[model samples]
Target: MEETRRPRLAWKIFKLFLVVLLVAFIAAAGGVAYVWNELQPPHKGEMVSFTIPAGTSSRDIADTLETKGIVKNGSFFWLYLKYKGEGARFQAGEYEMTPGMTLNEVIGKLNRGETVKEETIHFTVPEGYTLEQVAKKLEEQNAVSATAFLQLADKPPTALSEVLAGPLPTDNQVRHKLEGYLFPETYEMKKGSTAEDIMERMAEELKNKLSAIPDFDSRLKARGLTLHELLTVASLVEKESAVKEESPMIAGVIYNRLKAKMRLEIDATVQYALPEYKERLFEADLKTESPYNTYLHDGLPPGPIANPGLDSIEAALSPKDSKYLFYVTKKDGSRTHLFAETYEQHLKNIEESKKTAK
Candidate 1:
């Protein structure tokens, strides 16, 4: 009877141990389910936009995600990131997310820097555009205020003055102080950029481009041309040459005319002097009183007639060696010019151009 009592007691102790094990398993499973649910998104909702500024910590990012309703629980998200060793790789930028997005999806977007597309103002300033033209283009694109741009260009910020090779022209006759200094190129700026910002950026680009040339300063000195004068010649070449290959030749003609003390008589300058551009310049138009009218002026214009491209600027710095001093457009759809050494020859070329006109 004592042995039978001992066996029953041992069976009862073993059953109590099994019951405790089952209860513990159920509690562990319940904790895991709760944690898994918390790790998921809060609920279905519209997309939300947020910014993670540079230098924001991972824990702060998790909190922001929670505050933005991107995740169910900030603490849980922080714990998950620690467990996965992730959040350290997240990037900072503008982000768009929906509450229904999975944890993995949010993590993936942040890690990959899949930010929302930022609005940018994209514009292209054509190679020969004047400061006014640039202002108009900026206004057309809604990139900046045209009036503000022109005003800033008139008296650019002090910081921009450092980029110039020398001081701006003191000649009041100069049409615009920053006319040819603004490098012509396609630009993409943030939507809210100010006029001064754009002008500085373009001027800096011009400085950088000039710095890239080999022996640029020595070359300018050898030509006996100041930075302002060089740009003037380059703008003339840019306006005159329809075919890019002819730029050097056109520059040479101008140089030769200058050496001979002959008038530049550039049509583009006359056009610039006019109230507006005209397809054809009559004798009356050539007589416009502005100093920019090379036909009326005895030497180079007060300043550049327009902004010029690198090729035109290079051509002005190093012109082709030529005896030719006059040129007339072919007008034969070839967009070329007939160069001549004498006025008589130039007259003949003019007749030839007329014959070839479409």
Candidate 2:
């Protein structure tokens, strides 16, 4: 009986030794693998972000991370994750990885499932640009292809009118295109974005700017302008005055023209007639017939030429009291206008400013 007890004790000791050896082997192997991985140079690809979806297997993730240069070896990464019982913890979404990222950093990114938003470049769409004008500006940056962005404007269905409402006519006619709606402001857009994307952002900016104004809707209505037409008129006022102080006065000039059934000979209106703005407005430029030339036609042009700012909008709303029929802007930032309850006095102011200019 004593001999039998000794054998049992020996057997128990042997089994403990085997267990210890196995644990030590595992620990050494893990340590060697970690050291080897650390010694390996990062073979990760260019610095760019990528997406990993949820429920991805270790093998698939390893492959994807490898493609993005997040991992040097897929098999090793997969094996490591499985051995550490981390396979089930791998989250998926978007992630940015770089050659500079350590294996540990890659693992952290995967476990956290970081989502990366696309980087975007920005440009400001200035106040007082028509869709055509806006498109041209965008073209200069190689952002979008054409001025066709204006074609998507809100209008009653004439080709584009079917798509969006265009400029609102003075007699309460709504347009099918979006001539007056794209708000002017800075925007961030992905490279190679479509004109549609560009237009949508502008429209969104327009909505944002409009929402901030008090009683904006009523003001638009009272002015007998839709949001689109109001923008058109506002753009005119914005371009006409460099000084904010004179916006209301210039607005009064615009109003006087409308009231007197006279032409608004604003240089800004002439500028809108052509795609390339001429530095000087000539008598010939005034006579040129485009939907935008206020000199050739009587009422506000079919639509706004440029996106107008709040200064212009306020001027449109709160036009100052003036009997002025017309006004000429001066180089010194001053202005001269023809005011007339009488025709004689109106002509006198024009001839006087012209002679003084000479």
Tell me each candidate's TM-score. 0.80, 0.61
**Cα miss at 279, model 2 (Å)?**
3.2
**Where does candidate 2 stray beyond 4 Å?**
1-93, 97-119, 147-176, 274-276, 333-358
Residues 135-172, model 1: lDDT tens digits: 99999988898999999888877888877656788899
Highest lDDT: give the candidate number.
1
Residue-level lDDT of model 2, residues 73-156, one tens digit each, is 777777767777776767777777777676667677667766676767677777766667677778787787654554545432
> After best superposition, candidate 2 residue 35: deviation in angstroms?
21
Tell me the alpha-carbon RMSD of every candidate: 4.2, 6.7
Q: How much is the lDDT of residue 233 in candidate 2?
A: 68
Q: Residue 174: error of model 2 in Å?
A: 10
